[model samples]
Target: MIDTGEVRIQLRKGGHLKLERALGARVTSVRGTAWITAERNAGDVVILPGDSFIVPCDKLVLVGPLSGTVTLELQGARDAGSGALTHRRGPIAKLWALV
Candidate 1:
């Protein structure tokens, strides 16, 4: 969970960060390219420096460096379970379980 202002994070090569229930947050790449994948999303997103992506919903999202080290900035991200829907199981998860 991240506060509203802004938060910066650095990801080493081959390392990743998992963001859960990060709805409406904006991710911006500040350094190297960043690879972003979200649960239920068919395509992955790559953001270069100065680019940004807004989280669509409260789901599991993965962020990492495309190569080498990467720096990212997050804005308007809130704590997990803090959104309107606080249940641990989201609607989709409750409807169907994968594998």
Candidate 2:
């Protein structure tokens, strides 16, 4: 894919993102919220336990732990490319519980 023009990537809300090794994906980091990063060659599709900052390629420069522990997940909208959100944390069902 070349920069023939301006190609935009969109990620709708509401869905579950399931990442595997084949995608070379993992929980890069997390802070109050979770952060995930997928490889550049990864397919144009992703699922999260909840909402997420769905960035493309290595745009995810920083990913910290959402909670003191680690689970690699958060709740937010899909970031067009490498971005962050301060929404909820943990599974959608147990988000407020975190607080």
Candidate 3:
């Protein structure tokens, strides 16, 4: 899916952000540098301005800034040609969590 705009984030050096699968975020560095790590994925990724990294939907991810301050643009995944959030039906609690 594609997004026309993006969510912005700012992080200080050595600071981290916890991510959930609901976003399916595609993070693009706007300034400084950032390090990305996924719980179910091996290895770490570093991105500078103009670089982007995709976050998988089935795992947790941590994003940390490597520079004094880093700016990022986050684009969330959604159904193609649709604006609503959609996922497979699961337990009631999990389904309500999306709300």
Candidate 4:
């Protein structure tokens, strides 16, 4: 198993997402779909677009993938000041938006 202290999340941008750890997130469940995981409290999760993670493990910081040629989109954090939004560019995002 990957140790939480030595764990690193991968994003499609060839960069790492910014995250902070909480003391008692007590995440006991995490749900991942397709290629990515969404916000779930249980350490940190790496995900791609359209992926959803229901973390019931610990207080987790979610990392999503986003690039020019990527699929799936964790756009929940894209609005307001949630930081850099994870968007599945090109045709995928367009199709998802249509749905």
Q: Could you say which candidate leads in TM-score?
A: 1
lDDT of each: 0.72, 0.31, 0.65, 0.30
Model 1 lDDT at residue 5: 66
Q: Comparing 2 and 3 by lDDT, which wins?
A: 3
Please provide, for model 3 over 1-99, each residue's C-alpha lDDT reduced to its tens digit, 9 standing for 90 to 100: 544345676778766666655345588999989988888687999999999988765566777788698897766645443322221221122222232
lDDT, candidate 2, at 79: 26
lDDT (Cα, tens digit) per residue for candidate 1, span 1-99: 544466677778877767667678788999999999999998999999999999886788888899999898877745534543111222322111121
Ranking by lDDT: 1, 3, 2, 4
In angstroms, the error of model 1 at 58 is 0.9
Q: Is candidate 1 or candidate 2 better by lDDT?
A: 1
Whichever of 1 and 3 has more lDDT, that candidate is: 1
State which candidate has the highest lDDT.
1
Which residues of candidate 4, in runs, are more than 4 Å off?
Answer: 1-13, 19-40, 46-50, 54-70, 77-99
Model 2 error, position 31 (Å): 12
User: lDDT for model 3, on a 0 to 1 scale?
Assistant: 0.65
Candidate 1 Cα lDDT to native: 0.72
Q: Cα miss at 33, model 3 (Å)? A: 0.7
Give, for candidate 2, the lowest lDDT window spanning 10 residues.
1-10
**Model 3 stretches astray by more than 4 angstroms:** 1-4, 78-99
Candidate 4 C-alpha lDDT tens digits along 1-99 = 111221212235543332232222122212322222335533345443444444233233444434433332222211122222222332122221332
Each prediction's number of clashing residue pairs: 0, 12, 0, 26
Model 2: per-residue Cα lDDT at residue 13: 32
